[model samples]
Target: MNTGAVVRLTEATGVGRAVVGGKAAVLAELSVAGFAVPAGFVVTGAAPDDPELGGWMAEEAARLGGPRFAVRSSAAAEDLPDASYAGLYETRLDVPADRLAAAVRECFAAADSPRVADYRRNRGGDAAAMAVLVQVMVDAVAAGVAFTAHPLTGDRRQTVVTATQGFGEALVSGQAIGEEWLSTGHRATLSRRGPARVLTARQAEEVADLARLVAERYDGPQDVEWAIDRDGRLWLLQARPMTALPPPVSWAVPGPGLWMRNFRLGEWLPEPGTPLFATWLLPLLEAGYLDGMQATVGVRVPFRWTLVNGWYYNAPPVPSAALLVRVLRDGRRRAVTILFHALVQVGRDPAAADRAVLSALDRQWREQELPRYRRLVTVAAAEDPAADPRRLAEIVDQLGRHAGIALWYLAIVGGSAWKMEACLTRFARRHLAEVLPDADGGAQILLRGLSGAAPAFDAHAVLSADWYHPVAAELPTITAVTQSGDDRQSALAVARTAAEQRCAAALADRPRRLAQFETLLRVTQRYTVIREQQARTFTLAWPVLRRCARRLGQHLAEIGAISAIDDVFFCTRPELDTTATTDHAALTSAVAERREQWERQRRIAAPLTLGHPPRLIGDVIERTVQRARPAGTTAEHGSEVIVGHPASAGQATGPVRIITDPRDFPTFAGGDVLVARATAPAWTPLFARAAAVVTDGGTLAAHASLVAREYGIPAVVGTGNATSRLHSGQRVTVNGTDGTVTVHP
Candidate 1:
C-alpha cells in the first residue's frame, strides 16, 4: 500500500489487514457480509508522518462529492475483548468538505491524548498507530448501540439495542440514553405502545444475528454500533470486546422488602422526630418563604376537592437530596408566572376564590419552599452558633413549633393540591368539552392561564364609580358629604402607592423566612442527617419540646372535624353522594387501588405500622384525632361574616353569598359577597363583581387578595376556613387590625 494514499476498508482489509483498527475492520466484515456499506477511505498512521497524506485524503474526499462525512477515530490497539476505548477519542460528525483533512488530524491528536494513553495503560494495551476512517454519511432511518449480552446483568440470553430518532451518536456520546429491553434474540420491528412504550419484538433476533457474525469474525463478545439506512439494510460501523460482566442475580423486585434499600426519602422530606430541630426551624420564620415559591420553583400543586381523591404519583421520582441541592444551585430557574402566582397567593384571601388558588399556594410552599428551607436549616444548625443560653432555648422552642406548623401546612397543602387538579380536570370535562377534546392536558393549560394575571380587575374604577362595589352603600355618608376631602385624589393615590410598597416589601420577605422554616423542618425530619452527623462525632443538640397544641392551633387557621387513624398505613376512600357533584364511586375504587399501591411503594418501617385489620384501620384512624379547630378558641357570635388573612389593610362588609365552588357563579350577583375556599385561574371571572374577598389561607400577595386590591376591595386571608367560620347571611365586622373577625349578634 502507498503510505500517503487512501484506501477503502474493503480494499485494505481484504488484502492488507493490519493497517486499520477494529472499527474499520468490522465495517469491512459487514461489507463482505452482503450489507450496504458507505464508500470510505481509511487513512492509516502514515498520515501523521507524511503531511501530504492529509491533502491527499482531502482531495479524495472532494472527489467523492463531499457533502460531509463522519471522521471517526480507530486506534489500531483499541476495541479488544478486554477493553473498548469508546469516547476516549473523537468522532467529528457532519464535517465540512474543506475541513475533512483538519477533522481527521484533530481525531489523530485526540487519539494520541494522555487520556487515551492512560486508558490503554489501565486496560493492558500499548499506544499504537491510529487510523482515520472517512465515510460517506448515511441518511439513517434508525440508529442505535447494541450489545450482544446484557451489559448491566451479563445475561447472554438477551441482546439489548436502544434506538432513538436521528443520529445514533447522541446515544453513544451521553447526550441521550435510549429505552432498553431484554430480548430472545429475534429480529422484530420496534413500535411505541401505551405507557410502557418501545415494544421491540424479534429485534432481538437481528441483534443476535449481528452479534453472531462479530463473534465468528472477531472471536469474542462485541459491543456493536449499528444503523439501518433508508434502503432497509443493517450495517455495523464499529464493534469492540466487552470489558467486564456483572455477576448474575434476579434483579426484579420480589414483593415486600425486596428493593426497599433503593428508596431515598431524603429527597422528599426530613425524617420524623429527629432531635435536631435547629436546622428545621429558621425558614419557617422567613418572610418570603410562602410567596416567591411558585416563581422560584416549577410544578405548582393543585388544592381542590376533586383533586383530594386523585392519585399522587410523581413520574420518574425527584432526585436524591444531593441532586436536588445541586439542581437548586444550577440553571433550572423557575418561570416568571410561577413566581407571580406564588406571590399572589402569599398573603391573599383563600376563601373568596375557589379551591384552585389555595391549592397552588400550598403546593409552592410544600415542594419548593419546604425543600430549600430544610437544607438551609440543616446546614445552619450544623454550623457554630454564639447565641445566649436563654435565646438558644427560645429558638429551640420556636423551631419545634415551626416544625409542627410546617407538618400541618404540608398536609393541608398536599390535600388541596390534589383536589384542585381534579376540580380543574372535572370542570374541563363537563364545561369545556366543546373547547377541549382531551382533558389530559387540562391541568397544564389551566396552570398556564392562572400563572399569568390574565384577567385584569379595575379596582379604582369600581371604587370611584361605586359601580361593582358591594360595600359602596354600606359606608356612612356625612351630612352634605363634607368628608374632609382635601386633595383627595392625590392623597388617595399617594397612600395607595405607599400601601402597595408595604405589600411589595412583605411579598419580597416571604422567600427568606420560608427558607428558614424549611431548613429547620429538614433537620428535624431527617434521621440520616442525624446519624451521619453523629457518626462524624458531631454534637447532636437536644430537641426542645414545645406545646404541640398551641403550635397546631397557630399553624392551622381553621380546623374542621378531625379523624384519628388507628393505622396510618391503611387508607380508605370516603363515600359521598351525587349531591357532592363528584363521580365518587369511580374515584373511590380508583383511589382504593392506588392507596394500596402507594402504601406498598412507601413501605414504612414495621415499627411505624399498627397491627390493625386493614378494613377497619381507615375509619378507626379518623376517629382517633381531636376534631380540627382553627387557632384561637374564643366564643363565636351568631352573625354573617367572612374571615381571612389580613391581605389588604382594610375591610368592608356586604351581602354574603356562600359558594362552595367556581361553578356557583350564577348565584353571585354583582356586588354580592363571594365566599369560597380559594380562587383559581378560572375563578377570575367573579373577581370583578365581588365587594371584598376573604379566605382561610393566603398572604397579602395571594391572587384573590391582589385582585381584590386591584379591584379596590378589602380582603382578609389566612383565617383558616373562612367559609366554615363565617355563616351564610350573618352580619359581622372583619377587623383587619390585629387580624381578628368579630360578629355583631
Candidate 2:
C-alpha cells in the first residue's frame, strides 16, 4: 500500500483528501464541480522509485493522451486556509513521458529544501507529508495567473489578470513582465506597462469568469493559475486561497470635484483608516483645518472629504461665481501669512510679503495657536476616556480640532519653506551654478536646518508616527540616537557654513539680490526645522483618540456584541452611534465583515489621486519662480536605474535594506541603503545610520525627504516602483545629486 498505490484523477473522490493532499484533492473536486481540469493521477503513499509505480505511471501517461506531463508536489502543508506554501515545492512543467519518474522524484525531494524547512519552522505543522501529482500538460499558447479580487487594491468587485505569451512561470518568477489586465463587470482594461497584448479581451474575461467560479467553490477569493491552449480551450491548473489579502475597499470617487490621498492629511495616513478614525478623528481634523484657515487666511475653501476604499480623499469644491461670492462674504481679516501667500499665487513680487508673513505667523503660532492646541490636548488627554458617550465625544472633538489646526498652521504659514527654498534654488542656479558643482541639488545643502533634532523626532509627542497607532509596540525605536545629537547637529552646521561662504562669495557684487538671498537662505533653513517640529506634533491628539476607541471596544466586546476590543474600529460611526439599541448579533457580524475588508485594503496600491487633479498653491510658486527642474533619469554603468526626485544631497554605496513592516525594523543593519515604499516620522532614527535613503513614494518636502536632509544622506524619493524593482541585499549606488538609484549587477 505504501509503495505501489496509484489512483486515477477522475476516480479520486473528496473522501480521499487526507490520502492525496490539498492540491490533488482540489483538482478532483474541481472536476466533480464541472470545472475544466486536466486529467491527473495521484501516487498515494508510494515511493517515486517504486517498481509498480513506474509501470502504473507509464500506463496512465499513455491513457491520459499527453505528449508531455507536469509533475507537481501536493504536500499536506500546502494550500491550507491558514498557510499557502506557494512555490516552496517543485513543479516540473513540460516533462517528457520517459523522464516523468525523475520529475516526480524531484517534486518529492523538494520538500526537504532549506526554504521549505525555514517556512515549516515559522508556520509549523509541516511534516513533509507529500503526494506527487502527474498530469497531462496542456499545449498552452498563452498562460497566466488570476485573482478573483483585485489583489493590489483589495477591490473585491474587480478581478485582476496577469497574462503572458507562454508559461506563467516567467511572470511568477519575475523573469518576464506580463500584460496586467483588470476586469470589472465583464469589461477589462490592460495596463500600459509590460509587453504587447497576450490575452484577447474575451479570453481575459473567460479567465476571470473561471476564477470567480473557483472562488465561489472555495467560498473565498482565490488565486488561480490558468492556461489557454492553441485551440482556445482554457484549463484550470491550480487554485488556492489568496494569502494575506488586504481588506476589501471601494475605489469609486465619492461625490464630485478633484480628490487626492497623498496630499494634505492623506500624506500621514499611508494605509486605510479604521471606521472610528474616518468618522470621529477625520471630521474633527477637518474642522481644525477650517479653523486654521480662518485664523491664517481669514477665508474658507469649503473643503470636504470622504473615505474611498477606506482612505481619505479630500476635495476643495471647484470655484464658481457663487462659491467665490461665498468665500468673499466668509473672508475675515487676512493674516500676514495668507496675505503673502496671495502675492505668490498671483505671480507678483513677494519680497515684502515674505519678510512680514514669516515673522508674523511664527510669532502668532508660538504665542496663541500652538499654546491653545497644547492646552486643548493636555486638558482633554487628562480626561477619562471611559466616561459617558457625550463626554467622550466632546473630548474627541476637541482633540481632533486641535490636531487639524496644527496641520493648517504648517501648510498656511510654515509652508513658506517651499517658497524660500525655491528662491534660494533659483538664486544658486542663476548666480552660483558656476561655483556649486551640483547646481540642480544645491538647495538641499542650504536647507539642512539649524539643528540636528527637532520636536518632530519626539516619539512621545506623535503616537501615530507608527501608522498602526494603538497596535504598534510601545518600545522606543529610531529616537534613541538623540543622545548623539551633537554629531548630527555639527554636520548640519558645517554643511550650512560651507554653502553659505560659497553663496556669500557669489553675492558679493550685487547688494540688492545678496541681501535678499541671505534672507531666503536663513528662513529656508529655519522653516526646514519648523516643518518637522510641527509634523512631529500633528498627531499629538491620537493617543487620547485611541484610548477612547479601545474603551468603547472593550465595553462592546464585554457585552458580546463584537469579538474583540479592536473590532470597535471596524464599525461605522452611525452603527456605533446606535449600538446602544442595535441587535448584538447584527453588530457582531458587521464588525467581522468590515474588519476583514479593512485588513484587505492594506494590500491595495492606492492611486496618488482620483477624480480631476487640482492646481494647488505650491504649483503657483513653481510657475512664478525661476527654478532648476532636475533630470530624473540617466544611463550609467549598464545597471538597472530608478529615476526619482532628488531629495537629500549626498552619495553613498551599500546593500539595500528594505523595511516594509514596523516589525522588520530590528532586521536592519547600519550603513545599508534604506529602501521603503515610504518612511513615516518614526522612521527618522534609521536615517542616522543609513548610507542612503531610497523611497518608492515621497516628495522633496515629505517626511523622508526632510529627515534625510537633516542627516545629510543621499536620498532618491518618488521612484514609484522601486520596492518591486529593488530587493534586499542588492548592491546599489544611490546618487542623491542626480536623483537616481543605480543597481550594481
Candidate 3:
C-alpha cells in the first residue's frame, strides 16, 4: 500500500477492501472461485510518487507488455451490498502497458471527481481510499452485463444478461453491442438469435449459467459484468447490488372489468382565475424592437429547439448497439427537456397552443366519430368567429414548419461537434409522423424493410395526392394564415383569440371545459378505431407518403410556396424536368440564369421580408423557445404559491441563477442559484460547484439531486420551470422539505 506500489488482483482478498478497494476485492474473490480472472495489479490507497498517478500507472503498464489492459476503479464501498457505482467511475480499455500508469491515474482522478465524491458522500461512505485494478485485457468472443433479478421490475429468480461483441466495459455500462438475453431460474435461458449479431441457443445457456454463478456467489441479487473469451470461456469481472429500484406503490383496488386512469389534469388546466403574473418591464431601448415588429411578437413563437438540444450531441458516431444505449442513457436529459419545453411553450405560444388544440381535435375525431360512422363525436359549443377549422389547420401546419426550422438550426450549429444525422432523422420522422396517419402501418413497414431486400416502392407516386393529401391540404392554409399578420405579436394574438373563443364557446353549452375535454377524448377513441380498420390495407404506405411529402416540400420551395421567397429558393432542387423540345445543358443554363435573376430580386426584398413583424417575431420566438427550463418550488403565501426546486437536500436561503442555457453558465458564482431544466451526467461538474441544484424536471435520483445529496447541499427537482417562474438574482429560501422545492423570498 506504499506510494507507487501495486497489488495483483489474484493476490488481493476481501480484507484488502480497506487498502486495495472493492474492484481488486471482487477480482480476488472471482479468482478464488475459479473464474478466468485476468492477471492485474492494484494501486492501493497510497498516492504514487508521480504527480500524475495515471502517468505512472501507464509506465508500469508498459513493463507488463504494451498491447491491451483494463484500468478500472475499485472503491472501498463500490460494488458492495448496497449502491452500485456502475457509471460513477472510469475505466480505460485497450490501453498499452506503456500507458498503464496514466490510465490508472485517470481512474484515480475520476474516483475523486465531484460526482463520484458526491455519490460516496450520499451513501454515507468514506471517499478517501480508492484502489485501481489493472487486468490483462481479454480477446473476447462476447461480453455482457447480467443481473440476478430483473433490474427494471425487481423480479427476483430472473437473471438478465445482455451480451455484445468487444470489451466488457460496454456491457457493464449498458453500452454493449448486439444480441441480448433475459434468462429465468438458475438454469433457464432466453435469447433472440440471428445472423446479424444474434444469440445462439448454446450461448444462451452458457450466459444464463454465468449469471446464476455470480448471483449465487455474491450471496444476494447482483449485477454482474462478464465476458466470454475467444476460447468460449466465460469470465466474471465484477458484481454488485442493484440499487435503482423503488418499492411498489399501493393503490386502491378497482372493481372487476373496470380500471380508472389517472391524468395530470392540473398540468393541462390553466391556474384558477388567471394565474399571478410577475412581469419585468425591460428598458424600451433594451428591448431592441425591430421597425414594424412588435416586441411581444418574438415571445409568442415557441422556441422548442433550445431546450431539446440540452441532450443534443455534436457529431455522434454511427448508430451501433453501443452508441444507441449511450444515447438512451445520456439523452434522458434532452428527452425530459423536450417534453417540458413543448408543454410550457404550449401555455406561452399562441401558435403552439392552437396547434395542440387542433391535434387534440383531430385525434378525437379519428378515434371516436370516424370509426363508428353512426355516432357523431361531441363538439364544443363555444365557436369563436376567428377559430375556423380551416384557419386552425393552417396554423398547425405553419407551427410544424417553424419547428422543423428549429431542428435544422440545431443540427447545423452542432454539425461539427456531434452526429447531426440521427437528430435530423429523428426530428424529421417525428414531425412527419405527428401529421400523417398510419393508414396501413406503412411507415413502420417501410422502416422495417429498410435493411431488407424489399421492393423499391415508388414513394412519391404512392404516398402523394392520396394517403397524405388531406394533411397536405391543411399546409397551404397554414402557410396563408401564418404570414397573414406582419409580426409575431399580431399573429399570436390572432391565433390565440381564435383558439380561446373556440374553447370557451365549446365549453359554454357543456357548462365546463372538462365536459368539452371528455368529448375530445371520445373523438380520439373513434379515430383510433378507424385507423385500426385502415391498418389492414395500408401496411405499405409510409415510405411512399414520406417520399411524396419530401418531394412536395422541395417543390413548394421551388415555386415560392411559402412567404419566405428567398429561403424557399435556397432550398430548391437544381434541375426541373422539361418537355422533349428542350436540350439538356441549354435548358439547365436557362434555368440557372433565371434563378440568378430571381436571387438578385430576392436579396433586394430580403430586408423588406425580414422587417415584417411576423418574420422578426419568428426570430425572437426561436430564441425564447430554445431556452432551458429550471426547477423551482412552490410555497403557499397568502393567495399565491411560490415554486422552486431545492438544490441542496436541506433548507437554506440563497440567490437563484435562473439559468436558461449554457450562455448563463459563466454568470454563476459558488453558492449562487443553479436553476435549469433537468441535469445530465455532463452537468454534474456544475452540481459540485453550485450552491444548490434546482431543475424543472427530475425525481430523487435525478443528476442534480444526486450530486446535491453527495455534497450535502439542498436540492429540489421538478419545480416546473423555476428559472422562468423566478427572476434572476431573486433571493429565496429553498426547502427540500418532504421532496417539495418550496421557494420563499
- TM for every model, in the order presented, reads 0.35, 0.74, 0.36
Q: Which stretches of candidate 1 lie over 4 Å from their true place?
A: 1-5, 14-18, 51-66, 121-125, 185-212, 215-219, 250-745
What tens digits encode model 2's per-residue C-alpha lDDT throughout 577-692? 68778998998887788777777666566665566544443242123211334434342422256777677766789998878765576667778999987777667667767889
The lowest-lDDT stretch of 10 consecutive residues in candidate 3 is 273-282
* All candidates in order of lDDT, best leading: 2, 1, 3
* TM-score of model number 3: 0.36
Candidate 3: segments with Cα more than 4 A from true spot: 1-4, 50-67, 121-126, 174-177, 186-195, 246-745
lDDT accuracy of residue 323 in candidate 1: 53
Worst 10 residues of 1 by lDDT: 304-313
lDDT scores in order:
0.44, 0.71, 0.43
Per-residue accuracy of model 1 over 1-745 as CA lDDT, tens digit each? 3344466666655634357776777677677776556777888877677758756776677767758788898777667665767789889888877788788889988976899889888867766767888888766766677776666446666666666555689878877645443355364332111112222355435655776667567665567777776776666767777776553323332222211110111111111211111123322322122223324354333211100111111112222576555444542554333333333332132222223344455455546645654554454354315443344435544443344334334333322332233333343344344443331222122222121222332211111110111111222221122222223323434553453343334435577633433332222112112221111111111112222222221222222111221111111212111213445345445445544443332221111111222342232212211111112322232223333344433455676666653235556666666665445323444656666666544443344544444344555654544554454564445544224455444
Query: Which candidate number maximizes lDDT?
Result: 2
